[model samples]
Target: MTQPEQVTFPAARADATVDAVVARMRALDAVLPARDGVAVFNRVYLTVTEEIGRRLRGGEFPDPRAATALDVRFAERYLTAVDADAAGLRPPACWRPLFQLRRHPGVRPLQFALAGVNAHIGHDLPLAVVDACRAVGCEPADLEDEFEHVGEILVVLEERVREELMPGPDLLQLADPLTHLVGSWSLDRAREAAWAAARALWALRHRPDVAGEFTDRLDAVAGLAGRMLLTPLGHRTPRPR
Candidate 1:
């Protein structure tokens, strides 16, 4: 698989900022309990959604410059968090069962079960923020494109995490954190959290005024969600076949 291009910033400070976000995410992983992975993922995701809802409903932009900073921070935080998790080898061999389950007869039902949830949390909500930006004569096109780019990055991260961390032996073993987490929920809760965080960041980008505070909070949320996505603790496999 093609790796994402090296993330670079225009200035030294920007690069440092990105690195800091990555560091923070990495730190979070060290402290999280293995058992509470799903719960943590849900909380983070919910927080992201709540933040975005706040901005969308408020319709105010106080500090455009600060908002811009927030946008960059959020983007960096998200990218770094995912990248950091991808760096770790979690489940040790998660792909074997993931591949097997893909062909299962129940896969379609599983996908459908989570489709609405993912759609609202991932696509629709972010798009709404993009629409709001367009309505306000902001550079919606560029921001939307950036959002799409981030999604692409996320897909790559997920694939890598699956390949590296999934259990190879006894793919169905209960001790396999990746398999257990992915197969536990009807639809993976981590996806919801990631989507919610993405949507929230998108919404915050449009406001630009409160971006700083939003970015700080989002950094924490995204970090948690990213861990869930990478680690077996909170992950749910794509619907059963």
Candidate 2:
């Protein structure tokens, strides 16, 4: 349950930069045990953020400024949740499952990683788009190109976990529960849904009441998906005597 000591440049600052978020992830990576579920997710996310940084430097994103803003905002949400959980406060519904199950012995690292991915991509991405739009003085459509590029970078995380974390095709049967769990969610679909949700949220911004309700539902649905993803596939659960 312990997070690392404060990063020199916290991501929560008004003028937060992507570097600050990266630093925070590095700090968490350094302190969290490898087996901890949050740590597993953090490791995957750290790799993803680093890849985005590289892509940004390489001018892969057409709008680097917008991309940076979106990335920073997106990361800040998750870091804030981590801080909240560390402080014994409840995180958003989408994030609650991961935090609650972070230390569960029955869940596999892949489940932890994907469940975190589910919460972040499904819930945080849309809100981050809006926050970034407001910060950058643009609209959600303006950030679509940037969003797509960032998503492509995120796509790598799934590919990586499948290759590195899977029990192997030879050992993992087609009917394996782990296989089904991994198959149940699709990151590409999630990314598309997030984009649509962002657009919908932007359209509903004028009606805060409706928008708030929409976001609440979004959080709940994503949390449900996370709960499903975190289903224990291991034999760690004890049988009745």
Candidate 3:
């Protein structure tokens, strides 16, 4: 399949069922270049969505309704970003760096994947929690277990992705710049920060101004980390398959 110049998801589609989100991701996988930075992350995220869908179908979640709501809401954030980019509007700061640096040849696929992870975990996940809460008419504490379960799965996936994308042992010298760059960000730290941000946002739900300000600050900081993650290494190496 030829790669689409941009992935577009309508607002209506944002509220589509989790199966729809899974199908959308599958379509993206078919169209996007495997080596493209965004595509790299897309593949990882697709895996995650597939797992979530599977669990939902298997009746694994104690509260399937809440889980589905959380899953769909979480997915909509990513789709919204893609739609914004397609329309030439700026996506959230958390996502802008990945979209901007996506095509840079010098950036490794691993860097792109991790940068995407950074943005999603740091910014989108917290907001998704709030979205899910509203959709389910519940509080953050009610969905805490679901949140942690999803996050734990992501952590495992991140480890596997790192192993899969790791450069050859010889290429990973201690002094390599990639080492330092990748080392600077930790997913554990990002997850902790996300939980804190979610609690803060939930507490400020009645105060739009303060909540918006907090979100903007979070976005800016996550974007900065993403920018750092995408720093071109000038390696001239083709992105790993």
Candidate 4:
């Protein structure tokens, strides 16, 4: 495998603030190619973060401090995964497929975007929940509202992305394998799985071994779905409009 492209994001450290995360994402947006798969996902995620930041400023979250902590921790997981990939170290199972398939000519931008969503929500969100819980000194139940709110934003974003990226009416034939391929993944299912995983991890927190094993399994399962989403169709597909 080739060394991944060098895209510098802020280090995922104890003091990594949300502003720093947004700044790093913006930097990535400025430098990465528009057509790059990771760039596609990064743009969508950056939008989501910007919206969250706006909401935070608007006093939308019931517990603003908790929300900020959750958002920053959630983003750090994705950044950490990317950093690991860049260093040629093993990333989490969910992220490996995207990093490996990032430059494939046959994969469409929408596929790249959706695959990143899958890995983040499926594998990263649940763990991030636990991280936030620890940081906020609260239980997962306390962050439920914020979690659902963020998921709602992602659901809306996914719909718009699908609408914008879908091929024209002339290319919407059921016979096209791309149709079935794109239809296989669902953000709703991923969101549901994330909540369940969060609850399970919270329950197993005292048992580090069990929690570690469960997260590993979740990562591998999500990675499998990402790999399926990224399957190269051997033809050029329309990029997102």
Candidate 5:
């Protein structure tokens, strides 16, 4: 859509080293001053991915190959979306909000980050899970451990991002639009939902029509939630004390 003028984060196809991933994310992050929402989300995702890699190295996953397969598959969904965007084709419905609002002046960085998380967890993730199961030649149940572990790490990192970017003072008590928006979406719930959706998709794999409809509905709902999260609450004019 409109060439996605704001985001230029390159599409990643083949797997790369952690350093390479970090560099790609960091390069985009350097322009945060420009308020690129995609970059903020990319950084968050990168951090979570790095943590997952560490967990994989530490033998935390029962089946390391499955975990790696799942991670890579999950990433491909997003990267493919990016590639679609770059080609002036529509990315997934879920990613549309971030691409549209990446440069919105009234949207805070945290909102951008959370919206991206919502889109990924609610939409891309279930599909990723299905892709992983197929690639690893297993069922959804087989990769449950990796899925849950990744979700846990993601939750932790999301909290860290909030703390780092949250405006000082009592945000919760201020009746802030952001506080309400944040309440409307929960990463924990989104992760659980993704798991359920993944199982459903896997079960209906033989029924492509049913599976395709389910995925479309999921993407649209996630996109709606993301748009709500990215709603531009105009900046308050500071009172002259």
Candidate 6:
């Protein structure tokens, strides 16, 4: 007797919250300007925060309060990631961006945070988008424009955050370094980083046994960095607009 044919199951859809957050981020990048990468970071920050709130309300986390904490925690992590990536590059760019970033007294810390966040988030977000697109049988290249849109939103958010949070004498000086950093970055590099981050996250998602371990490690790194860079700032309290 002939053996029956075997069937294969389709890949599972990505988590809805992750998809929603990435989609919104991509949208923000579309309208982002070349000189405004920080804006994209800011929008992603707010979007992620809101999503965490939603997930908490829906009881998606073991401790609902953890969701709220993640909102702020991730924002700082994103910033740190961007800074670390930029620092790793060689000269004549080595530390040039960092030097420029230091020019803004009031806005420097925030800009540093945003840059770090962008570098790190940019590394992974594109990959996630590409994977999702592929899962739906779409070309990853098609998502490039969307990624740029998210970048734009990040710039806008950064500007708005600065305007609201640090409207000090040197506030406008922040724009110069930001413009320089954006101009220095190539889209290709951003795309590559995105691909890496997405694949890493994808791997973590599929391996349930290690997912907690991976997140715990990420949390530990982020926590250590946050304590070093963010805890001293004491600027989490959003200024009234």
Tell me, by lDDT, which candidate is best: 2
Q: What tens-digit string does per-residue lDDT give for candidate 4 at 77-149?
A: 9888877776778888898888888889988888899999999999999999999999989999999999998
Worst 10-residue lDDT window, candidate 3 = 1-10
Alpha-carbon runs more than 4 Å astray in model 6: 1-44, 47-116, 170-241
Query: What's the TM for model 4?
Result: 0.92
Better of 2 and 6 by lDDT: 2
Q: Candidate 2 overall Cα lDDT vs. reference? A: 0.87
Residues 1-241, candidate 2, lDDT per residue (tens digit)?
4344452233398688788789899988887789888889989998888888888888888999999999999999899888887766788999988888888888988899999999998899999999999999999999999998888878877898878877666433465788887898999999999999999999999999999999999999999999999987765223336
Give stretches of model 5 more than 4 Å off.
1-34, 169-173, 236-241
- Model 1 stretches with alpha carbons more than 4 Å out: 1-16, 33-137, 168-241
Better of 2 and 5 by lDDT: 2
TM-score of 6: 0.34
- In the predicted model 5, the residue pairs found to clash are none
- Sequence-dependent TM-score of model 1: 0.32
Error of 1 at 137 (Å): 8.0
- Which 10 successive residues of model 1 have the least lDDT summed? 91-100
TM-score to true structure, per model: 0.32, 0.92, 0.92, 0.92, 0.88, 0.34
Clashes of each: 15, 0, 0, 0, 0, 28
**lDDT of the candidates, in the order given:** 0.37, 0.87, 0.85, 0.86, 0.81, 0.42
lDDT (C-alpha) at residue 219 in model 1: 40
Top-down lDDT ranking: 2, 4, 3, 5, 6, 1
lDDT of 6 at 72: 33
lDDT of 6 by residue, 142-179 (tens): 44444444445545655555565344444343454443
**What is candidate 1's lDDT per residue for 181-209, written digit by digit as tens?**
44543323544454455456666775777
As a whole number from 0 to 100, the lDDT of residue 238 in candidate 5 is: 54
| lDDT tens per residue, model 5, 41-105 | 88888888778878888999889888887887777677667667767889889999998888888
RMSD of each: 15.1, 3.7, 3.2, 2.6, 2.8, 17.2
Q: For model 3, what is the C-alpha lDDT against the true structure?
A: 0.85
